[model samples]
Target: MKLKKPIASLVSVVLLSIGMATLVTSPASAHTNAVSATCSALSVDLQLYAASREGSPAEGYTEYQWTRTVVDNAAWTEYVRYTYTPKKHGKADPADASSTPLTDPSHWNADNKTYDNSAVDTYIHSGNGEGSWFWWIATTHEAKTHLETKWSKNEPAGDGWVKTGDSRFHETSPAVEAKTNHVAVTIDGTKVENTDFSTTFTKNYPFSDKYTSHTYSVVVTAWDDPMGTHGWTFTKSGSSIACTPPVVQVTAVFPEPVAPTCTTDGALPSLPTDQTGITFSWDENNSLKMVANADKGYVLTGATFNIYEKPGTATGDCYVPLEPVTVAPQTCQVGDGGVADFSGGSITLPTIAGVTYTVKTSGGEPVTITDGKATGLAPGDYTVTALPAEGKILTAGETGWKVGEDGSATITVTVGASADCSVVQPDSKVTSTEWADGTWACDATTVKQTREVTTTPYIWVDGAWVLDTAKAATVTEKQTRDLLASERTVCTEVLAAPPNTVVTIVPPTCTADGSATLANGVGYTWDKTSFGPGLWTATATVADGYAFDNGSTYQVTFLVSPKLTGGACSVSQVLAAPPNSGTFSQVLAAAPNASTAAVLAATGATPLPLAIVAMVLIGAGVVLQPRVRRAIFTRH
Candidate 1:
């Protein structure tokens, strides 16, 4: 049973510990509560601390109890009347007892005996109002068997009296015995004050002040001193606490953006429009300018300038004297048609005072020029003619001009290279002695030939050689020469002529024309005139692209005779001539009568066949007979 008691205590402790685990609750956050108490004169203060005042409702109930011992000494005495009746004597009268009070135990009598003498007794009773007890009232008396005497109080008799003697006088003592008392005082089952009170304890409570307020309960118990055996008394106190949260402030931060960049070498830069810190404008110099306030807490620093195009000056000149002017030249065989090769030739005119230039072909009309442009020229040799200003003479030899002493010049275009003698050769000259017969000899002439000569006659009046208006003249000397003997003989005597110089004349036929031909292919035209009957002379003219041999004409003579059968013939004849050196004369026979000639002239009459009695003569008196021959004739 003793072992069971210990085991039961262990089981109870384990059960209590396990139950406490389930009863435990989570606390707000991980923070613990702080509490403290202080004792002072007649006052006690309690304090609680925590992360915040808001948490599980706090429990701070306290009890103050006290215990003490005290001594109590109270005393009292009472008197009672007793009547004694003897057994043998009939009812004796009760009386008050004095000596040997019922309270005196040793004086008490018993054994169913009666008091022989009734006496009055005094009794004492003592109590602290906690309990009461009575003892038998005793007296020294002998009981009578038949007559009993009972002591009775004036009031009612209580128990604890053994009825030992029907009535006995009970007396109370005057002093009561002293007693020691144990006293205890308590509040809410706690001990304090007179019991030497001192204690320390800590307890945790859950609380939270995340939003609303929560207060901590902290109780303080105190007591006043118990004067002498008086139990201690106490009063309870607690601290007033309200949890409050501190105010919190929050700040926001943002990320900064990268600054925009610009270029100097490319086209116009596009500025950022969304940027708040940058501004753009044109300065007074018309240059692009940018400003940045850096309102976003950034630093702006760099070098900048305006870009533009600058105005510049350039110098140049146009010389009027070097202005282009053209005067084309032509190349040709002398006296033939040709064109100038102006493909590579041009000129620059000058503005010299009193100097003017004219252009024209040799032996052609002058061409007009206005402002360095000239009228077009035909295919021919040309000259750029000019005259020097007054008081300025032509520069000799360098101007390629035929300049005169009068200061005029011509730009003469040479037909060939400057050194070619064929283009610059001088005219030939011949001197011949005359025969004593008053005729020039053929092989006896002395020839004097002039050497070729070239001259630059152009005047450089305007940076170029130009023809002068006044040009040097080429002088020609006329010399007359008589024909040579061969020429004269050939001219007078037809057989003496050179074969190339021979002339053949055909005799005229009554029905056909006559012709003349020269063997040298030197074509000629003819001229004829009449010198009376049967006498006619004709002359020859050489054609173009041909020349007479040393300027002489040859001649041939021939004749024709006809016979007539009737006196005064009525027949008529006409003759046709071929191409010859000169024109031929028309021959007509006198009509047989004036009326017949009139009729012939009037009707343009046809001719009748008849014998002719006429004479035909050529050159100088040469004659021959006529014959009837058939031939064709044409007038030319």
Candidate 2:
């Protein structure tokens, strides 16, 4: 029973021991295999700091410090070393025993001395029961020295170096705290704020080791002020001081003003007035005279005497002074006195039947003459005189004239004749004896007579014909004689020749009756004779009383023209009547017999053959007219 108990206990012990060993070892083995598996799966980023060599100190030395970040696993811990070496037991041993110091193996210098471990192996084991293990180690795996370091020691410092406290140290020290501050900046006299300010610190000692210094920078944010802030306070390192802000300048803007001027409307005023006493004569009559009251005064500056008239009126008479005539002060006042004279008054005789009167005077008291004349003159001839009262003398006076008895005031006159009247009577009268003879006696006609008479009669005023009463008469007369005898007897006795009187007669010619007739002839009458006789005379008188034979009957002739024969006859003829055809009878004379009468008749009747033949042919042609036409037609 004791043996069984001991054996069972031993078995139990072995089994528990084996089970615990399996549990622990299995986990360790799994962890190691998982690490190797993770290393196999991860991408290996190999960075070398230095070549592998014998033992050396890993101070102030870096190989992969400048390299980029790479993926690493737990297997990467083998590459961390102080120095580099080769393999051990047919496997790489990055933590080699030969790279333990950083000094030379053959010599030693205390001033520049480093850790010396030359006498060492060149390889190191990596598994259980290997050489002494280190977290970082240098390697000499390829017969060359190499260095490796921790990743944190060989990274970039964040905020770079800065000036700080009494001792310079890496800001990563746990004893130091970080802070934030600001700096000021200005631009063109305006301010800015909230500029980023930062700095860094590093260690003073550990010359071979590098420390990340705190870095400071300005981000330069903007502000409302034009000038900006570029200053920093000692916030993180607390070592910076303050400074004065920079200055800037500027200018301003505005506006300006203006000026003024003056002007006027039109031309200036003028003046002209008449003088009182003095005859202020000028060479030119049209000179301008200053008026009594124009404006106050003349603006002679910048003005010329353009023209002259009244103020504000363009057209009055202008009297331009020969020179500039300045009026004496107060001379134009009212109630001033002056004088002119008219002294010597004289009369003159004109050469052309007229009169002239004149005043002869010189300068004296001012006075005028009243009405005055010279009297006591007659129509014959006279002379008159005049005398001036004061301050004068007569220069021309006496005159002469030729006068007449007529009532006229002229210096010369002529007389003319007066009117007269008269009557004229016949010197002798016709006698009674001449009237009693009973011929064409003008005295027996008893026609009243008149005479033209003229006389100058005077009325018995104061017993004589004084100058006012002369008168006259005038007459004229016409008379006629009466005849008591027959007109033929009167013509024979008074207007005929004595005994052998030869008379001219114009006989009658053809009339409308186609024969000459005495009733169609013109007749005449005569005046009575102073001595009686029985014979009578006649003449053929035209309707105007002109005798055709001119009262001489030496030969009697008549002109005749045939009248147109109408009624189956047409003839044109002219003839003349014989002279002395009418019978003349006187008392106690023998009668003419037939033979004498035939002679007389033959003489009186001379046949015109053309007229006779024209009548006869007209009668014959009228009788044979139809037969002749019939004979002509038969012959044709």
Tens-digit lDDT string for candidate 2 (545-576): 11232343322222222233455434333332
What's model 1's overall lDDT? 0.34
Against the true structure, candidate 2 reaches a TM-score of 0.13
Model 2, residue 445: distance off in Å is 4.3
Candidate 1 per-residue C-alpha lDDT over 479-512 given as tens digits, one digit per residue, 9 for 90 to 100: 4444434443211211222223334444434333
- The most accurate candidate by lDDT is 1
Per-model lDDT = 0.34, 0.26
**TM-scores across all candidates?**
0.13, 0.13
Off by over 4 Å in 1: 1-351, 414-636
